[model samples]
Target: MHFLIIGGGFVGTALACELLKQAPAGSSITLANSGGPLGKGLAYGTQSPLHLLNVPAARMSWTDEQPDDFVNWLAGQGNTCDGAAFVPRQRYGDYLAVRLREHIAARPDVHWQQLQNRIDSLTPEAGRWIAQCAHGPALTADRVLLALGNFAPACPHPSLQALPADRYVGDPWQPDALSGLPADAPVALIGTGLTMLDLLISLQAMGHHGPVLAISRRGLLPKPHRENELPPPQWQAPAGWLAAGSLRSQLREVRQAIGRAQANGQDWRDVWVALRPRTTALWHRLDERARAQFLRHLLPFWDVHRHRAAPQALAVLRAAQAQGRVQAAAGRLLGARVDADGLVALQWRARGGQDTQEFKAARVFNCTGPSTRLAEGRRGLFGHLLHDGRLRPCPLGLGLEVGAGYALADAEGREQPGLFYVGPMLRSQHWEATAVPELRAHAKAAARAALGC
Candidate 1:
């Protein structure tokens, strides 16, 4: 058997390593990615030391069986850090790369290959999948896994279209996106999520002393991780709450749980942590309407609470806010244009205001998070798959639809055998799929399925 894994990010690398451990002798695996340090992806590729993992080192292992693997590895490198410490993301990336190399060295009987090229398309022919590369020879494999990580952030404000291309940045991950801008020039950012925090930290590291404006609908920032560990909550929702079968009821119950936990002198984070294990089951129980309502009304609030920032990073952001170097506003961008003086003019209305206000900045960045709608403006290999009717978007537009065993499903609800996916897109099926704790297991399961284990 031969396997082809695209998008050599953390997930792809983990999948390859798992296959190496489980596959039979003579089985081959090929991992392909556009040129970059494998396993880092955009999240861990940042050079700034300020970028820290939201998750603690203890829970971020390649596999669940060895929960302290990351911390053990850190200790081996002479870093005397505890399991609960939040370390730099680059360190984690280094760990992943080293783990991949170790697996490859230990399993010479299995053929391992790396292709540093982007896949342009995937065509099914002669009982195998043929992957066409953007700048290399095509390759065929018995199984293909689309491990594409997060997509680029979509431009949310239409007014940004009028601004000069040089003055507006649609993707913050691009190497040259921040180039040419003066350090002291005012800058505007679109979202107030983790991505926005990362950019702000990057700017601070670059010695940027200019005013920064961040605008979003609610302008809610992520909460900070707790400094001390609290006992995990043992409370469970009442059966009546679960039977309500509505998103509103579930939210009310969650709020009540937090209230109860607080009343008992327990941290609310403990309650949330206790609920994490059951999140997928609860999400699957919701009907389509209930799920849509949750997305529309509660997603932002849930995101900020569920996905928190490192305490150290959050302190920096709060310090910037206190110093007035950074400002966050709750509003929407009505429009933007380049002024006669080459400055960018932005017009926006507050959350509950009729009148629009204007602000000018030297540059603007779209950090509104990755686009979830899979079918809109499809590009590259994913676009080709959608165009060829091999893939279809989930009902909530979160990602592509998949069947049992991570098999890609088409619009007609037919699963495509020998084709799989293992990445953030699994969120459509499993709401709690993005973090390392969940993703590592997903990658392992997908690898087992691909290899017929």
Candidate 2:
């Protein structure tokens, strides 16, 4: 039976690799990705050495069963760095590419096709799925895995919503979005996440001297890397706190638990490491109300603590703040209109019911992160699937609805055969599906289900 994986990011690559490792010889597998092969997507395609991974190298293996896989590959390439160190993302991408190439070279019996074409839609025919590529002819596969990763950011503000291309920088991942701006033009960064940091680095590299205004609801910044700390041994949290208690109370208890760990000379990273395994379980325990409450009230705080910046990147952010080049403020955008200068005019309300203030940005960039609502987008195969009743979105609209085994559900919420989702697209169902550890496990499980093993 032929297997088709849509997307060529880390999850897709790892899935393809794992299938080849376990499946019988001569198995046909086709990986359809617009960018082709390993490091094809945005996360791995970046060339900046300054951009480091949030997780350390030790925790970023392709599989938990193979703990030292990535580090060993890096070592084989004559890299003498410490195994636990957080390496450049570019190096990680290179490692993935090297492994993919080695696997392809060694697997003579397996036919792996890397098609550099986007999948426009998926149609079911004769117990198989037909994937229509943007340019190439359609290919039929017995099983299909949707491994598509990140989506473009969703702008929530009207000032941002009605922005024209000339007055906005829609996608921060593309470096050219910041190109050709006047050297001294005042710029506005919509969110203060890692993507915002990336744009800051790009601007600094280009030697742009304009003041940057980064505004968010809380103006929260990512915590910096804990570099000097050792590889933290796992520690246990208060039992059942994350599951049966209120989120606010649980957070307080967790804060107290961290204090206790620190008193014992252990770092908070240990607590974080321990929580990683139970995050999904804890998230699942929360009801819809609790989940929504967490999203509304605790998401910003959780994100700042969860996704940290590299030490080097943190230093840049700190230095910029000290120099007054970067301004982080908390406010809600009230209204936005176009001015005579053809720029975005924004009204914002400050913290604690302060007076509304007006600001005009020569360029307003949306770094608010990925769009979770699939139906909101004009393109993508999932939208088409939803419209045709092939798939229904999760209640939260975060992704396609799926069952426990990651099997795609129909419009009536019934499980569908031969269709599976294996990455961040399952975020609504599994909050922890976005990263490597969870993704690798999900890929393995999906492979097992697909192969009937």
TM-score of 2: 0.94
As for candidate 2, its clashing pairs are none
- Backbone clashes for every candidate come to 0, 0
Q: Give me the candidate number with maximum lDDT.
A: 1
Query: How many clashes in candidate 2?
Result: 0
Cα error of candidate 1 at position 393, Å: 0.7
lDDT (10s digit) by residue, model 2, range 1-453:
799998888988888877877777878988888873465467877767777777778778878898888888878888866665878888888877777777777788888888878888988898889888889699899989888876788875755767777678778877578777887778888888888887788778778888888888888999876884345475676656566677778778788878999999877777877777778887777788888888888889878877877777878878999999888888787877778987678788876667998778888888888876766744668778877787776666566678777778888888778888887878777788878888999999988888878
Clashes of 1: 0
Candidate number of the best TM-score = 1
Q: Model 1: per-residue lDDT, tens digit, 1-453?
A: 888999878898889889989989998999998947888988788777789999889889988889999999999999869777889999988899999999999999999998899999998888899999998689999999988976888778777866788889999889988888899899999999998988998888888989999999998999888864333455655555445456777788788889997898767787688678878988889888888988998999999999988888888789899999999999978989999988998888999999999888999999899876787878998888889898878878888778878989876878998899988988888988789989999998898898887
* Residue pairs that clash (backbone atoms under 3 angstroms), model 1: none
* TM-score of each model, in listed order: 0.97, 0.94
